[model samples]
Target: MKFAALLRSAALVTAVALIPATTATMAQVDGRAGPEFAKLFAVFQRVKASYVEPVEDDVLIRGAIDGMLAALDPHSAYLDGGDLQRLETMIDGNYSGLGLSVVMEDGAVKVVSPFKGSPADKAGIKAGDFITHLDGTLIYGGSLDDAVAQMRGPSGTSIKLTIFRPGRDEPVEVDVTRGVIELEPVTHELGAGNIGVITVNEFSADVGADVFSAWQDIKKEAAGRVAGLVLDLRNNPGGSLDESVALADLFLTDGRIVSQRGRARGETMLYDAETVYRGDMAEGVPLVVLINAGSASASEIVAGALQDHRRALIMGERSFGKGSVQSLLPLGPDAALKLTTARYFTPSGKSVQEGGIKPDIAVPQISDPDFALRQKYQTRESDLRGHLINELGIKDEEMESDSIADPRFQLTSAQLEEQGVKDFQLHYAMETLRRTTKSTVALRPAKR
Candidate 1:
């Protein structure tokens, strides 16, 4: 018999003899399944019967798959077979959907940020917007998976969203038509004094090659007269690790890029720079990396490595604290698991989990009048430690900041504001680059 037929027979036999209800469902859906499907069903049955509590079969099945995949490493994930096909499309940086990056925050699905040029951004879906309803149905308490499923649909379909913006007393309504969201990975502009401004959206599969190409293009366009390079990693929620390391290698001549430590693993695994690929760019070219709360994962690795080694000056808000590494494991033919396998540390041996990489100079994004007060306080190590202590009842001594410093890192908030540099962090970095000497710049006190 064919593989599909064998799977169907096995599923029918197991379901009829063991879990009638689950078996019935599997058999009905097993018409096109293969041997792998039968094996998965068998594992699901064993888990349902053996699990401590009377768990829902679906939950048990999903949990088992998740546990299975999480063991490999972080980043690999199992998408539902149908979603899997769509995922392949997404990796290509084009997908038809309502454009919004979302996450489960405080038990509610919140909008992280809307992509530039996306329908959501055009509709004014700013970061910190709380999504309360989808299609006029209350979805605040729903799972993120369910929320995403509801928000995504075929192209040209209209969906109404009720959002709570910070300043507004009442929730605002937005009607957005789903369209193809194409991510422009690298965008460049010629800034003042022939400086090059390059913005990296995300380190997708082709990001390494794309960045190398962009760098060449920038050099060619500027003809070796480029004064400075601003690499904007703001709001870039990371992608491929290989891309991150490869991109870092482009800038550094030598040094450890990043390291990973796992719970059961004996020791941390280190990734060091093997080769320097600067292309046609000159050595000692002044570079500045702009990061923000949205920079994470692979983005953090690059920024942290560069900052640790003093290869580039880092400026902007603190990055998103996502230092844990995840690995995806294939559970069955149709299901997969994405699990946190290890925690990543920068070359300086700092754990970025909960505590993110602090910028050499901090610069806050100006928020709308409504959000000003809420985001007034800078997210500092002490503040994060206090939060952890209060919420988790952990001792203050348990929290620690990673040790990484550059003698030239001197720009602070008060000093920047006092100097009348509204975006002082970036200004300081630019000025420091202009000077181009290995000397520290003293921060002037804020003017009263």
Candidate 2:
């Protein structure tokens, strides 16, 4: 079955609960009525009473809820009771079932990507795989929300997935047993010349404390005076917004970390820097932040704030565009709605909406031969030309000269190849820090 049909099925199921015959009187008496509500009720009632076959009220209500939320945006979604439980497990850094991020695309549920170290990842579930069935049931006619509800369960639970892979004539079936998934917040190591390399996976509730703990550990290992710091934020789909603000304040003594503006809000609320630097580190240290397409929301906030404040040099591909802020609204009876409440801005007042923050230097990843071949065929020089123009906001005349180049910006494909850093974004950051720190030491005054 087609993906669109599945989504329609899910939406239809949720809409049953909101059938006008069952809900209009209560909704109106509850004082939530306006012209929109009145029209919605009329249509819902007409559909429920006019349908030839008897339809369950529960199914209609659920479908309405799903349709309502899905209309808002891709990220804002209505999670059923079971799906909500799974989200709670993810936030707590533990969950069961196939660890894959799936979304309704082109009406069929498609795998966004499998989480690293997940059963789905290990089982070779690739991005863009269309889930045709779950267990013995035909999932092609259901909503993505309902599909997720069917997929999640307790640890050690086994689920079978039938996927339609690209370039394959026949579908593939994979049976995977769920396991407890634990997220690693901070991972640090001492690189060449005693440089501190720290990778922050996500900005969860405990991320602030975890970063501090990692910094202390790295400081001890470095014996003070670490040459430089390479903070890796690649593939980090952001979590807590509050945590991102707090994390940015750790390295900044004074400045507006971030700001938020809503539809009605004329004034922009600013989050200022902490009074003191919590970490025992001085300002003007050589810092390089690594970012890529996966760095989003809170991660983009940190990268943008730091780059705007001149605290760190951002090096990598453009980040994921997710500037909108979401607030969790409790819908009585143990249900909640995660709604997009506001749009965030960098300290410099740039709105990173569809347009993401541009890196100080653009280093295209060409480490893999297969990736290079794909790029050659799919993306020509003209493709990158528009990206440079749009991201830099430069006119065609400005590119006539070579003034756009910066001396500090260096590409590290060769060095990365030598170090076997297929994930070359992080290697580029480390090398940038090493070069910047050497320059800083040379420019420093001699000891008295």
Candidate 1 per-residue lDDT, tens place, 1-448, comes to 2222222322110001011222222224456667878887897888778877787876776666655544443333455654444333334447778888776655677776687678898887877688999889999776778888788788899899999876567889999998888877677776556667777777665666777777778778885576777788877777666677777887776668888775543324677876445432435467788887778778888888878877777887777766766543333555433445466778887766656677876644432333344354323223432121122333435543334554444555455457666544455556656665434321111122
- RMSD in order of candidates: 11.5, 9.4
Candidate 1 positional error at 68, Å: 11
* Candidate 2: regions farther than 4 A off: 1-33, 110-113, 121-138, 149-177, 265-268, 275-284, 368-419, 438-448
Q: Which candidate is the best by TM-score?
A: 2
Task: Estimate the TM-score for candidate 2.
Answer: 0.73
- Compared with the true structure, model 1 gives a TM-score of 0.70
Tens-place lDDT per residue, model 2, 1-448, is 2222222222110011111212222223446547777887787888799988877887787778867876775555555466555455444446566777676665678775577677888887865578998886788767666887677778888899999876567889999888766766578888877788888776655666677777778878986577778778866767666677777777776777788775533323577778324532535567777876666778888888788877777877776666666544445445555555567788887866545667877765555333433323331112221111133354444322233544443445565578677666566667767777544432232232
Cα distance off (Å), candidate 1, residue 160: 2.1
TM-scores of the candidates are 0.70, 0.73
lDDT of 1 at 178: 89
